[model samples]
Target: MSLYMLPLAIGPWQIALIVVIVLLLFGGKKIPELMRGLGSGIKEFKDASKEEDKDEKAKKE
Candidate 1:
């Protein structure tokens, strides 16, 4: 099979290890703030995409 067909192989151990690394690098307090900012950025991106779609539909109509 081609590499493109292969599923991601990450398991619980890998997830735990990554979480530990992030905690060590950013500490517990900063992680929440980072996550909040990331969430807001994603929300803004979604809103922008919806607005763009509306604009495209308006133009086509």
Candidate 2:
């Protein structure tokens, strides 16, 4: 059995089109608020992971 993988390429125009679709769906006013929430969620996840790593190190020592 042979498996073939195709390359996926995304160019500037494709990104611009995606941005346009998102803007249409979310509207300009809500994008900033949504982005802010997403940013905070990501930050919280990182902080939790760091705490877990510190606890693991303390246990090993």
Candidate 3:
């Protein structure tokens, strides 16, 4: 099966369904903690990328 055959664009109904499924699976109490972890992970990834860019610039000098 080719990946191009998939309908990759997500509509509002798909988003709502995904949110509903996540709520059902994780419950209300865990969502905040999950979001916090996700946020921190993204922050660390951004910091790492910035540091890598600085290192590359330093090497080019």
Candidate 4:
């Protein structure tokens, strides 16, 4: 298998267009709620990982 990679082609204009569409669809208030949910989801994932590490350490002891 070749170690060289193919480029996945997404550019700045496409990303900006997507962002504009999302903003138009969701509006400002909904965007904040969506962002808050995203933040909490990330936080929950981090907390879960920390808990799993503690469990592994306990089991090793």
Pitting candidate 2 against candidate 4, the one with the higher lDDT is: 2
Q: Model 2: per-residue lDDT, tens digit, 1-59?
A: 22343234667998999999999999999999999999999999999999999999999
For 1-61, candidate 1 gives per-residue lDDT tens digits of: 6687566767899899999999999999999999999999999999999999999999999
TM-score of each: 0.89, 0.83, 0.88, 0.79
Candidate number achieving the greatest lDDT relative to the actual structure: 3
Task: Arrange candidates by TM-score, descending.
Answer: 1, 3, 2, 4
What overall lDDT goes with each candidate model? 0.95, 0.92, 0.96, 0.90
Sorting all predicted structures by lDDT, with the top scorer first, yields 3, 1, 2, 4
Residue 4 lDDT (model 2) = 42
Model 4 regions more than 4 Å off: 1-8
Error of 1 at 9 (Å): 1.8
Which ranges in model 3 have alpha carbons more than 4 Å from their true place?
1-6
lDDT winner between candidates 2 and 3: 3
Model 1: colliding residue pairs: none
Question: Model 3: per-residue lDDT, tens digit, 1-61?
Answer: 4588567877899999999999999999999999999999999999999999999999999
RMSD of model 2 against the true structure: 3.5
| Tens-digit lDDT string for candidate 4 (23-43) | 999997799899999999999
Error of 1 at 52 (Å): 0.4
